[model samples]
Target: MRLQGKLAIVTAAASGMGRAGVERFVREGAQVAAIDIDPAALKALAAEFEGVHTIAADLATEQGALDSIDQGVAALGGADILWAHAGMPGPASVEDLDMTAYRKAIDLNITSAALGAGRVAPHMRKRGGGSIIFTSSISGLVGSMMSPIYSAAKFGVVGLGKSLALALAADGIRVNVVCPGLADTPMKLGFTGRSGDPAEAAANEAKVVGAVPMGRLVKPGEVADAALWLASDEASFVTGVALPVDGGFTAR
Candidate 1:
């Protein structure tokens, strides 16, 4: 029970890394507030988990991130950890990008993560110390030929984590970011726009997998494990890291 007695709030909790974090944190004995825009999935999580509280809200705006944390603090008594992660891939090319859509997508990927962590910092500080983890991407660690804007947003997340780590060190709040490669998640399917076509989806996934040295996609649980470690007392001395759970994609 590494996180026993801890209270945590995770964004994007309906699926992907968010859902996995909820499951893992609860299993390790943390009370959690699961926030997402998907009401149905959040409802299901609340119904299944004894200590989970669900909040359906978009994390793409400053107000949205703040509102979720406010409700979360009220529900969980206080928060000891924050997995301040909720984002989606934006346009694949610079030419295809709609500036309006770009702003919204970047808000979700970078702005919300930074705002959410900032809002939660004080609450964690009040508890003496707490962990704050952001979900970035391997694209954040390196340039992406296919998604330059999206890569920029992910890179911003890493910068947020590093800066916060230093700013909150004296408050005993540790900040870190997790950079994941292609994972078997809805985001990947949506990125390819082939979620409905099994054959096409498989082909796309295969291509994504082939680029990874591991020959497979990273699992949600694996990324969750990394976040869990950073959130636990086991990582009391660790912070400001852009840890990659990317099957060694960045190494290449």
Candidate 2:
């Protein structure tokens, strides 16, 4: 019951770490507003959690991000936590320089978090304090040969988290980033471009696992556990940290 009676807004909440976070927050007694681009998945999430509010919106735009937060806050009556977890894999590499994909990486991964934080902060201030969590990647800390665009966007997220943590401290708002390494989620397949070839997928996974000192993929729930701590009162004195749930992947 770490988050009992709390109100939260989670983006990309239909699957992976976002879904796990929503489930954990609710189980700990929080009423949540789950936001996702997938309407059907949002519906399923609403069904799974009787009291959860679900919003389907594309978060890559300023209006979309702001509107979702406004609507979520209205639905929940107030907000204590905003986990801006929506993100997408950018182009496979930077050699081609796909401007479309590059812009998308910046928008969906970083800009949306900024907009969401701006919109949610006022609501949080009204409630005395709040937590703002962003999802970055280990790529944020280090360069990624696979996708430099994704790396740039994720790095921006880490910077945003630190900057906002300092900017919002006076309002009792804690801003932090969660940098996940090679987790067992759909995004893992996304990183490898899950084609029909099973061998190719397995090979890619093995390569990624080989880089992790733990020699295994981090679980989605494990990332959620880290985020849950940030969202709760236990982290009251914590802020501006880019926590890595990377299973020692970053250690190397």
Candidate 3:
């Protein structure tokens, strides 16, 4: 109930951390706008949440990001929190990287966050204050040899949070970033490949687990909880923080 009666907009909300965030916010008493690019997923989300507003839009563009926020504001009357969580991971290694794909990944992962916040800032300002939370990764703090592009993009997100925090503080708007370690999600499964040989899959899983000090992956709900805290009044004095929801991975 920390977010009772608040209005929120969560992008990439059809799956993974975004989907979990929408569910968590709703349970915390916030009216939420769940957005994603998948029409079928958005439809399912709308059906699943009676009062939630579901939006299907390509967040790779500034207009799409702005339009979705506009619709969300109109649906819920206004927005008190904006969680710009739309992103994609890039090549695991530079040798496997394609420039075109890398550009798209950076655009989707970094540019969308910047534009999404830019479009929503005015509306939050009109209300006198609001919170903006961007999604980052533990790779953001360090560098990922496996996915250098993803690491770079997430690093940009962390930078965005800090810069926006200082820029918007005068207007009572707080900007923060959540850096989650490896999480068990459909996307991760895709990246790891479920249909691979059993031995290969086991090895892959072991490799992932071995990287984290906790010996387990972060859960989507855990990331959502961190995001929920940042969006709620409990974090009123918290801003410009890159909170690590990682299981001590960054510690080592």
Name the candidate that leads on lDDT: 2
User: What are the lDDT scores of the predictions, listed in order?
Assistant: 0.89, 0.93, 0.89
* Each prediction's TM-score versus the true structure: 0.95, 0.97, 0.94
Q: Candidate 1 vs candidate 2: which has greater lDDT?
A: 2
Stretches of model 1 off by over 4 angstroms after superposition: 194-201
Clashes of each: 0, 0, 1
> Residue-wise lDDT of candidate 1 within 1-252, one digit each (tens)?
999999999999989888999999999999999999999998888888876999999888778888999999899989899998798878767785688879988999988887888788888888898999999999899997656888999999999899999999999999999999888887887565534787876787787788899889999989999999999999999999999998888887
RMSD of each: 1.6, 1.2, 1.8
TM-score of 2: 0.97
Return the clash pairs for model 3, or none: 92-146
* TM-score: model 1 vs. ground truth: 0.95
lDDT of 3: 0.89
Q: Rank candidates, TM-score, best first.
A: 2, 1, 3
lDDT of 2: 0.93
